[model samples]
Target chain A: MSITVAVDAMGGDVGLDVTIPASIRFLQDHPEHRLILVGDLPAIEARLSALSADARARIELVHATQVVGMDEPPQLALKNKKDSSMRVAINQVKEGRAQACVSAGNTGALMATARFVLKTLPGIDRPAIAKLMPTVKGTSCVLDLGANVDCTPEQLLQFGIMGAELVGSLTRRERPTVGLLNIGSEDIKGNETVKQAGELLRGSALNFYGNIEGDDIYRGTVDVVVCDGFTGNVALKTSEGLAHMVSVFLREEFTRTWWTRLCALAALPVLRHFKARVDTRRYNGASLLGLRGIVVKSHGGTDALGFRFALEQACEEVGSNVIGHIADQVALQLEKIQRPAVEPSTTPETL
Target chain B: MSITVAVDAMGGDVGLDVTIPASIRFLQDHPEHRLILVGDLPAIEARLSALSADARARIELVHATQVVGMDEPPQLALKNKKDSSMRVAINQVKEGRAQACVSAGNTGALMATARFVLKTLPGIDRPAIAKLMPTVKGTSCVLDLGANVDCTPEQLLQFGIMGAELVGSLTRRERPTVGLLNIGSEDIKGNETVKQAGELLRGSALNFYGNIEGDDIYRGTVDVVVCDGFTGNVALKTSEGLAHMVSVFLREEFTRTWWTRLCALAALPVLRHFKARVDTRRYNGASLLGLRGIVVKSHGGTDALGFRFALEQACEEVGSNVIGHIADQVALQLEKIQRPAVEPSTTPETL
Candidate 1:
């Protein structure tokens, strides 16, 4: 079946200028897949009118009455902006009008909207935002990138399982190795919650790689690293901060003197190549995993190329059946591991 | 008032190979300061015998029968190895034999030993590891790096207070700005713990810069970034990892072809200049603030030069009286803010 992605056209900093162009660009490459643009009708139509007639044929529009402000409270956005572009796009996935949804909007509102519209999968207490971060080797997927800040031990275990399944599907690794993010690699490290979660993951059927420190995220030590939203979000943002700082430092150093400027000229190609490898825009899309439907959150400040990457990520998830694959794995693992007296608090009925 | 720093001679990866030379080098530069080397008698003496006559005059060796293994449990190391270099060095600080202590040993053991021996100052429930991290502007001091993984809102506020004082002393800024690290900068962002800490900081005497996200650490948005130990440690390590990854990628790219290798050679001076700007070794020492005595934890794997920088940090802390400064500030802030019924649960007895 042809994949249909719901594009939240009114979301992000540049809104339709980026979304419409990105949808058009993505359609050119992905001829089989169609896009349903969900946003303010007049604005979207204005952008759409500029597109060629053939490009418009592969697109559909679902008008959204409201737009969630970037800084609006997630709860207020959820309650009041029922007809927001972000919510409407997610609704397309819930109602089977689209195979997946992509939005470059307020992260909190996007997560809240997706969770509310699509709901969680069976046996899942909470959904996590799984982010792909660049590493030395390739990239590693990290989960709970600010979904639920205070997660129980069981929820962390679920994140490990879901993250493992998602990475496994994307990378085509039979079982992606999962690492629990902590302050130290030792089992005795971290707080009570992390230690308990380690025990649960170790007993499960996952390819558990034990505890990993913060550096391991970029070291590419494991396929997936799992943590509560608070830790994961901080780690992710700190990396971004460091990367930006390094770039700024490099620019300042390369322009310090005439000799350094000449050196910069000689190293321009290598620097450009290095920039491509560590560019944050290349890793823009973050999958809001664990929901019944696929919803990818793009960086609000990203360009059309970055938005297209988010669309590509959504298409890949749809093709790989990530949601179904994770559900089956979660069910199978829970059944085998939950048999012992030390079962998780989540009841079988939840599964 | 000669500043005497107790050195854990038998700590870290290479032990005396780094410590002895670092101590000698540090003493050569700071003519007024002294170092009391604490470790196995014979081993320390053998290394010390190689030092110059002038260096030897300012150095004293204290015999410690045991050494704390890098991987030993903190509690186990504390109980069994009372005479360990790590423990003995801390004891020197506690007994006023030294003004400060520096160790490149087990972080947990160092924190545990220092807390048990030196104890926390009044109004300081727990000691925190305040780390100096490189930023675009210069460097920002972040705490608690790993001392208390699970910190309460009150403890976080105390971290902000202590961190502010420590930075104030080191940077010589009368009122160093403090930023509470969180997922977002908005008042509504972060979990309950972070939110409460914001409230406490806002109502206190600190130069609160408000909430800052991860990138703000590298952006040098504030002088002191305060968070729970878990978040601080994770953010710190993640930046290290990314820096390492980028360097690896740069090396790989620069050596990819003959032309690129030539480019690397041309850019060698610029690259070296950039490295010096962001060198981790320059920011080696981590101050274990909140304790009655001063303790600095050096990275376990650092070499002589890095160890020397850690010694410099210890000397600076001693000269600035970080501990006394923090104690006075904490007391003042507590007295001013504790009048409200919303006083923290930490009683005067605990303080």
Candidate 2:
């Protein structure tokens, strides 16, 4: 049977300008794949009608009456707006009508709706949002972005397992090494939570590489890095800020003189390629793991190209069967968690 | 009256190469200042003897045979390394022989020694390590860098007061805004610890700006950002890693062509200025707040220039009476901590 992906048409700052065209482009390229546009019907159709004949023929629309505002609370909106773009998109996946769902809407709303529709896997406490942030090694995924803030040692151990599975499956790595983000690289550097978690990770079934420091997070040192939503969220935003600052500093330095600007013109091609290497857009969406169906939350400020990338990532996750692997890993880890063994605590920093 | 600044000549990777020379430089620049170099007297004196005529006349050496290893546990070293560079440095400050102590040794050892010799402020539970990191809006100070992990709400409130006092005294801002870093910008998005910290922050008398996201930290949005040492440590390290990545990316991007190299050459002056602005050397030291006498820990890899900058920073803190201000702020905040106070139960992610 042919597979279908649901696109949240009304989401993101630059709505259908890129979304509609990108979806059509994807369908034209893949004959077996289909699209279910979940947003305003007339608005999408009105935009599509203006496109070429081939673009019009490849599109289908499924109306989602309400749109989740960027500022609205995710759980509140999902509870109140049953037919919001976020909900409709995930519902399409939950109902088995679509293989995966992609949304550039509120992360909270997307995560909340995903939990309700896809439901958590067996033995999973809470779902976490995992984003593949650009790092020195390649790309490293940091989980619990905002799903659950106060993660327990058990949750962190689970995150390690799940993160390892995702990283190993997505990247061409086998049994990737996992590191617990801590203040220092020593085994005895972190707080009580990390200390206890470190013990658990040491004894767990995964390829735990002991503790890593915050500086080690984006160093591409580990295959999987796990932490609470608060720490993970902080790391993601700090990286973005640094990246932004770097770009600002480079541009400022580049335009310092007339000669420098001329050099900028000559080396624009290489600079463009470098920018692509560190481009956050190419990283695309954060997968909401521990859920039955694939749900990727695209960056809120995503462009058409980013949305297309998000779609590609969602399809990859479904095709890779990472969820099944995570389930297997979790099932394996479950046996160890139940054992009456105690491990000493250590974090990334003091390892 | 002569002001004394004790220097740990046997600390850090470069040890005397950076610390002794930097101490001599500081003394030469500030003729009124008294120098008491703490370490192996012969080794420090040898380095001092190599300095120019003017610096030698202004500098003196105090012998301390022990030097704490970077990998040693702080507690064990505190117990055994009684005559270590860190202990001797802080001891001089405590004995009224020096007004402040500066070390580029093991941070934990320095912090431990400062506490052992100088003691904590009255009614203070623990001392915090506060750092001044480069940000878009010039720079900002974050406290409890690696001092106390898994900090309680009460501890976070204390961190806010001490950090605010330090920032205000150093940055000279009337009331530096304090932000409780968390996953979201809302009043209630984080776990129990952060949620409770928010309540304590709001109840306390410091100038709190509610909750701030990770992205806003580097934007210079808040002057004193408060969190548990675990989270603070992660944020600091992550920011450092990102900054390093940015520089590396630029270096690689600039090497793309000969024209880019020419551009880099022409932009060298401006780039140097930019580099100096964000360089770790300018803000190499982290102040150990709550100690009776001023103490600063320079990075282990710090060079002579970094050591010089750290010595200058210690002088500024001493001259400004940063700890005295923190003591005064603590007295004010202590009264607020006693009341049933607003419940600190709401996490940051919920807000």
Candidate 3:
């Protein structure tokens, strides 16, 4: 099955320098995929002039007169930059011209523009930013990274459902286990919203793993970790800060003297292997789940290689039909809740 | 002046094994300090039989008949375990027999009992847990780790003041910069409570650095980083998880094969130095701030070295008169807010 993805070519810190190259590389690697590059025509063409005919045949260009600034406010971007590259890219997804959209623009602006254009899935009050994080056993999907600072218990339940569906589709897992993020693992922990969310999750159709602490994210104790955006964002950013600091500390120790530098040279291969095991670029894309169409947000500061990983992520979501799965799951859950007289033996099996 | 700290000898995972030796080491190191060991007489005597005469002279044994289980609920521990080592240790502070208390018991029980015994300072609503985290520049003090799940705007302002006072007294920095932790550094970021807290911090006499993201905690952008307990707890635990994962990855890479093992041996010294730089044991103690008396909670799973560090922390707090400083700071801020006619030039100087 062929998938088409719209790229915000004029977005991110380096604009065309990263996006254009990333798009060309993705097209070359994915023969069954096509891309619509949305940006300034002259600028995009300048970078793509060296592409082969086969790659050019798989690519389309859409002109956008404006570009959203990396630090622009979300509300202003949504209201004023209607013709921006980010907006045009999302429009392709809304109009069915592309199955998914990929952007490395300002996160707030991307979320606002995409939500404005594509709307949200039915029964989902708000869209959440879900991202894959590296864990000891494997990767865990955590949601609401920074989309909504304050989340209702119902919204958290929706996030759990959407997260389970996303994981199920991507990994072909029949029933992914979901865990509510809390300060403690016990039932009587966290704020009122989280406690209420835990009860809702326990009674839902999804496989609810009890409450999990922050350390459980790296432990890979559950497939899906759900929390309010404020907590999730803080956890994610704190991890990044810690990882950076450790690397800096390692560098300082490795170069303290000539003998230590020599030892570092001898251990270079092992260090490189360790770095590859926890590379952030491999997990560059964050999906805006619960949206009507698939939209993946790349890290704004990433290079072409990292942006290519994001494009690949978009293609994977499109091919797996994640949106349909989420919609079906939501409807099924609602039906189960509404039908009060249904017996346990007569209930339908979960997906 | 000699400062005496009450030690809960039957707390933590290792119980008497860790606390007794740690207390003996602490007493040997600080001749001007003393310890009141509270636990079962037989168990406490068994460990202290090997201590020197000089060390024994500075130590006092106060037998407590009961013990608080590590997993016991806070309310139950507070009500049922009246003569528990944890409770008895806290009572020493209440009865003015000890200047401060150190415990490695259940955090909830420690907080509940400490608050019940010491009560809160005049202008403080609740006690917050503040601990020092290593950062790129030096170290940043953050609070409240998990005391209150839901905090009001006024409570957050109180936390900022408490955090500023803690850092100021500990580092002797007269005026420490305080940063409100949020998802973004912009004034428009975070939830309503955080936004209001930011406004309050800015208007106060603190060296208010408007707002900081999670990364700022590690970057040491400010001396004191303040947040609601839920967010702070998640951030702290997430850092622990990430650091653990990285170390595990490094070990796997180093022991992958004989060649890698050889490289690891060659780089052992540099690796040890790196490990010591980011040692969690060195930063073991967490201060329960805003209470009328001093209390430090150690990690439940720590060894003798870590518990000794907690003892050192309690002694430092007692010597610095942290409670008095916090009370003074809170009162001064309250007075400034109440007297609306005080001009900026006529305002009293902050501690």
**What are the DockQ scores of the candidates, in order?**
0.85, 0.53, 0.80
For all the models shown, what interface RMSD does each have? 0.7, 2.0, 0.6
Taking all chains together, each candidate's TM-score versus the true structure is 0.96, 0.93, 0.96
Question: Which candidate, 2 or 3, has the higher DockQ?
Answer: 3
**Candidate 3 C-alpha lDDT tens digits along A257-313:** 999999999999999999988889999999999999999999998999999999998
Residue-level lDDT tens digits of model 2 in A37-110: 98989888887765556545545688988999988987789789898877988899888888898888888888
The lDDT-based order of candidates, best leading, equals 3, 1, 2
Kindly list the per-residue Cα lDDT of model 1 for residues A1-351, writing each as its tens digit.
Answer: 589999999899988889989999998887788999998898888877767677789899999999999988999999999999999999999999999999999989998888888899988999999988888878789999988889988999999999987887677777889999999988988999999999999999889999999999999999999999989988888887888888999999999999999999999999999999887888989999989999999999999999999999999899999999999988988777777756645568658
lDDT (tens digit, per residue) of candidate 3 on B110-216: 99999998899998888999999999988889999999999988788888898887887677877889999999989999999999888888888989998898888
lDDT of 3 at A202: 88
Question: Lowest lDDT 10-mer window, candidate 2 chain B?
Answer: B338-347
Sort by TM-score, top down from the best:
3, 1, 2
Instruction: Identify the superior model by lDDT, candidate 2 or candidate 3.
Output: 3
Clashing pairs in 3: none
TM-score, cand. 3 vs. native = 0.96
Candidate 1, residue A92: the lDDT equals 93
Off by over 4 Å in 1: A341-351, B342-351
Which residues of candidate 3, in runs, are more than 4 Å off?
A: A338-351, B340-351
| lDDT tens digits by residue: candidate 2, B1-351 | 457788888899978888876777787788778788889887776666567776676666788989999877889889999999878888888988888888888888788778887899985889888987777787778877889886777788888998898887778888889999887878877878788989989987888998887777778789988877777788889988877776787787777679777756755666676787778888898888888889988899989889988888888888788888888888877866774445664568668
